[model samples]
Target: MVQAYILIQTDMGRAGDVSAACAEIDGVVSAEDVTGGYDVIVKVEANTVDELGKLVLAKIQKVQGIVRTQTCTVVHV
Candidate 1:
């Protein structure tokens, strides 16, 4: 399985809205509003890298209030 953490940046004052929307997406395990350069952070998992990509690009990015995102895939040593 592939796992990733997506760091999301949203428009000012929209972090809660973004987190709420992202939480309902299929691949998103959890989304939380936090204080940092990014507004929301989401954890996601899928059976393949391609599927993970689709989850990030097609699903997560489509949520309203999101401005930008950086995806970090987990690597096992």
Candidate 2:
């Protein structure tokens, strides 16, 4: 599986709602409200890299309160 950590930014006071929505997405393993530049941090997995991109673009990004996201793909060396 392809795994990544998605750092999400949300509209002010919407972190809880955004994280909750992301947590329910099929590929999302976990989503939590967080502090710092990003509001929510999500762990997600998909069958392939393409699917990962799709999950981010077609699913997670579509969450109502999400403003922006940065995907950090996991790599094994």
Off by over 4 Å in 1: none
What value does the lDDT take at residue 21 in candidate 2? 90
Q: Among all windows of ten consecutive residues in candidate 2, which has the lowest summed lDDT?
A: 68-77
Which ranges in model 2 have alpha carbons more than 4 Å from their true place?
none
Q: For residues 1-77, write the lDDT of model 2, one tens digit per residue.
A: 88999999999999999999998899899999999999999999999999999999999999998889999999961
Backbone clashes in each candidate structure, one number apiece? Answer: 0, 0
lDDT against the true structure, per candidate, is 0.93, 0.94
TM-score of 1: 0.96
Show pairs that collide, candidate 2.
Answer: none
Candidate 1, after superposition: displacement of residue 4 in Å?
Answer: 0.4
Q: How close is candidate 2 to the true structure, as a TM-score?
A: 0.96
TM-score for each candidate, following the candidate numbering:
0.96, 0.96
Error of 1 at 60 (Å): 0.4
Residue 66, candidate 2: Cα error in Å is: 0.9
